[model samples]
Target: MHGKTSLIEHNGEGVFQGLNNPLTVTRYHSLVIDPPTLPSEFNVTARSASGEIMGIRHREWDLEGVQFHPESILSEQGHQLLANFLKR
Candidate 1:
């Protein structure tokens, strides 16, 4: 789902379920915007199938960002996603 405004762009952000760093998450009408370019060593953990950025994860840092509504009732794994984040 694509939109004009900065937020409420896509419905779901297709993510990569990597072996080492699993981050397969879903969104419900996401409003967050992905950065145009990431700094060196910064890895994009998740993104839309069309290549639209979704989530960014720093390689050496504990910082991370999700360009989706992982806390919304419409989200599939909203609670689980937040729980995983808190565990990390």
Candidate 2:
């Protein structure tokens, strides 16, 4: 996927439950797909709460995304990130 480098947080609610840290991320950009319209309450990581979109979810469609590299070894919660997404 095409993306950019960033850091994100996993708020307790939503798809990122049981995680909260300033994680290094990669925000992907899709040339063919339009990004989902996220709600204001889409919980951003604590460090990014000031101004940053970390994760988003479209519950009706069962789609969600985290702007961080949750699978990367760089993330402390990498394994959890994958588990959370897979579980959902």
Candidate 3:
């Protein structure tokens, strides 16, 4: 999954809390063709400017995922995001 860039806007209340900026750029490939219906145990933590789901977490499980590649150079604050995940 690699191509254009997307804006990941943090919801500011989950794993992404305390981020220096509310939005960051990241490389994205896959598109959420359908609106997701996440399980009740999961909480959405971020989204694209167009409202696509970009990040999610399960608080109880200490699990999380993002549609964009945080390791990619295109991601602003990618290191911080990874650090936050690691600190959790």
Candidate 3 lDDT, 1-88, residue by residue in tens: 4667776677775557677455666665776624456877877778888888888888698788877877778777778778888887
Rate residue 50 of model 3 by lDDT.
83
Model number with the top TM-score: 3
- All candidates' lDDT scores? 0.53, 0.56, 0.73
Model 2: per-residue Cα lDDT over 3-71, one tens digit each: 555555555655567775655555454222222544554423333433555566664566676555666
Native-vs-model 3 lDDT? 0.73
What is model 3's C-alpha RMSD? Answer: 2.3
Task: Write the candidate numbers in order of decreasing TM-score.
Answer: 3, 1, 2
**In terms of TM-score, how similar is model 3 to the real structure?**
0.79
Distance (Å) between predicted and true CA of 20, model 1?
Answer: 16
The alpha-carbon deviation from the true structure for residue 56 of candidate 3, after best TM-score superposition, in angstroms, is 0.7
Where does model 3 exceed 4 Å of error? none
Off by over 4 Å in 2: 1-7, 21-50
Q: TM-score for model 2?
A: 0.56
**TM-scores for all candidates?**
0.60, 0.56, 0.79
